[model samples]
Target: MSKINLKKILTYGLVVFFIVGAVGNLIGPEKILEDYARWGYPNGFHLVTGSFELLAAILIFKSSTRFIGSLLASCIMFSAILTLSYHAEYSHAFIPLIVFMLLLVSIYLHKQKKLL
Candidate 1:
């Protein structure tokens, strides 16, 4: 596959992931709140994060705003990973950290057209 095709695929996949996460948070507020509470965040934070994720998803779907959206989404994931690392056991934090790092790499590849 070509570099451009790989970038497009990754971008589409990331957008779908973000959109699904946003929709999940919106549809399952209680589950998200439960997870957040376990990580020590307040109930209101779930709504705020959900909104941010939704907006990021929308922005990511647009080519013009993709880089900024990817950066913001990375920030959000990084924040969540840190929060979980701070409050939860190490094992619980590992997955998020790995996921966030993968996201960072994905964004980097997209930016450099190296995904091919």
Candidate 2:
């Protein structure tokens, strides 16, 4: 596929990904709560994460702010990767790592498009 198409696909896909992440964190399901606790995060930290994820999703959905959104998402994904890796939760780390890489590509595409 063309770069334009690829970028569109990645951008929309990331928007969806962040939206889901935001909801999952905001909902604070038992498994997620336990994971956050296991990672030594303060109680209610998920709220902050969810808020940022939601912001990223919003920014990403807008063409004018896609790069900025990707940057914000990259930060979150990086933190997740670090936390998971530090805890030796490699399996859990995998998804964040993949998302982080996709965010990087999305950012690059935005830069190439001079949308940054």
Candidate 3:
């Protein structure tokens, strides 16, 4: 497959991932609420995070706004990593770190004009 096709696949994949995450946050699953409580965040904070994720996912689909979307996504992942690490939840931190790396890759590809 061509490089552009790869980029499109990655971009769309990230968008879908963020959208699903947003839905999960908005839906306020019990485990998710428990995690937030354990992390010392207010119960309502999940809604804020979910809103940002939903917004970022929408912006990521547009070439002109993809950079901003990636930046927002990266920041969110970074925050998760920091929080998880601070709480000594190293195992949980792994996934956020991976997500952060993916966001970086998306940013790099966008800069290279491979993705929107």
- What's the C-alpha lDDT at position 36 in model 1? 77
lDDT of 2 at 25: 97
How big is the RMSD of model 3?
2.5
| lDDT score for residue 82 of model 1 | 78
Over 4 Å off, model 2: 1-4
Error of 3 at 20 (Å): 0.9
Best by TM-score: 2
lDDT, candidates in the order shown = 0.75, 0.93, 0.90
- Model 3 residue 33 lDDT score: 93
lDDT tens digits, residue span 1-116, model 1: 64567667767777777787778777766667788788777767777787888887888788778778888888878887778767756676776576577668666765775346
lDDT value for model 2: 0.93
State the weakest 10-residue window (summed lDDT) of model 2. Answer: 1-10
Question: In terms of lDDT, which candidate is stronger, 1 or 2?
Answer: 2
1-116: candidate 3 lDDT, tens digit per residue:
64568778878988998999999999999999999999999868999989999998998888899999999999998998999999999998998898889889989988888534
Collision pairs in model 3: none
lDDT of 2 by residue, 11-115 (tens): 889999999999999999999999899999999999999999999999999989888899999999999999999999999899999999999998888888894
Model 1 is weakest, by summed lDDT over 10 consecutive residues, at 107-116
* Pairs that collide, model 1: none
Which stretches of candidate 3 lie above 4 Å from their native place?
1-4, 114-116
Reference-based TM-score of each model? 0.77, 0.93, 0.91
